[model samples]
Target: MGAMDVVLVHGIFDNGAVFRRLADALADAGHRCWVPALKPADGRTGIEDLVAKLHAYIDRHLGSDAEVALVGFRMGCIVSRYYLQMRDGVRRTKALNVATGPDPEVGDAPKPTLSTSGC
Candidate 1:
């Protein structure tokens, strides 16, 4: 397929830099990708804050009629879900991709619960 615009979201305790390799690959394949760093990324950011950041990024960067796809990794999935469902996202969203993985530990990580719905 031809080049497409995309946003790559990082997981908790991680920053946008983590997507460097994947971003390079996407660039090589002719896709425009952005890996924006979200605040409180060290597994302590509240879900609401992350959601707000995502919404602001889209509002400020994307055009009114722009069609873009979302690719959220791990905790990012939850952020994307909330954005699409509660922020009038379907109008501009072309596709949504979410990647989830099993938690490696529950040891000292903050235990936060989340519930979301989206198309």
Candidate 2:
């Protein structure tokens, strides 16, 4: 298989430097890893801005043919999930490796349909 592209998105109050070990390991294994620092912002505005930033970073670095993976913590998971929902063709991203909230109650709350291929 070709080299895989991995995108590491840090959680609130944290920065991309948090992924140094993981990024180093992935790169050692021949995969391309990215952990661009999410630009600082206020609580409310940061979410969407971070998501857009991640999306743009992925597009600029990985291109269309590369597989994209996300690693986020806490509120970062929500941001990553929201981005995954809106992004097309790029299905199956990894979540929960970092801290996150309770798993959604599928029936009680609206849930997005994720493709059953990759994670």
Candidate 3:
């Protein structure tokens, strides 16, 4: 496959830097990766804020490039789900929820309950 641009969004308590290894691996496989830094500071930001931030970032960086995919971890996955509900132009997007669940605002999607089984 040819090179395609990728956008990686990290979960709470972590930044885009968290995806460095994964992005590198993808790059090695001939795909361009973009792991934008979302706010990692605790209590200062929330998932809604992140969704807006990521949307703007994708618009700015990818800009009409539909050959893009997303890798969202944990809370990032929630953001991606909402984005997917809202985003209409992107051609491809993959959401990887490392340890997470549906967005609270998604309503009726069954908010996930925490357990030892993992987030």
Candidate 4:
């Protein structure tokens, strides 16, 4: 299969700069990648702010037809979910990787139908 576009979201104490090597590797592999910094006050800022920034960056950098895979490290996972749920942007996103964090229990929570096909 062809490579999918991806956006890297950083966690606390970082600003997407940490994903530089990963981004470069992805780019070199022919997949479009972006590492936009979404700074918060070291967990002081709300997730909404970060989510909004994520949406803005995607809208401005990626076109409307772009479908990307979101890879989040630590708190960035929370930010990714908010953007996917609140903005209903899941349809435009291919996958979400919630790494370096605890996995959430979305089975009981009210959200979109997440199945193994996309898993």
lDDT of each: 0.71, 0.63, 0.63, 0.75
Candidate 4's residue-wise lDDT over 48-101, tens digit each?
A: 788888899998999766888888788777777777888676878887776775
User: TM-score for each prediction?
Assistant: 0.77, 0.72, 0.70, 0.82
lDDT of 2: 0.63
Which candidate do you rate higher for lDDT, 1 or 4? 4
Q: Put down candidate 1 lDDT per residue, 36-110, tens digits, no spaces.
A: 788888657677788888878877787656776777888786677666766666667776776773352533333
User: Which residue runs of candidate 3 sit more than 4 Å off their true CA positions?
Assistant: 40-44, 89-119
Residue range with the least summed lDDT across 10 consecutive positions in model 1: 110-119
Q: In terms of TM-score, how similar is model 1 to the real structure? A: 0.77
Tens-digit lDDT track of model 3 for 20-106: 888788888888888887764342676667777787888888785555666667767666665666554234453223336444676
Off by over 4 Å in 2: 89-102, 106-112, 115-119
Pairs that collide, model 2: none
Candidate 4 regions with alpha-carbon error over 4 angstroms: 106-119
Which candidate has the top score in TM-score?
Answer: 4
- Higher-scoring candidate on TM-score, 1 or 2: 1
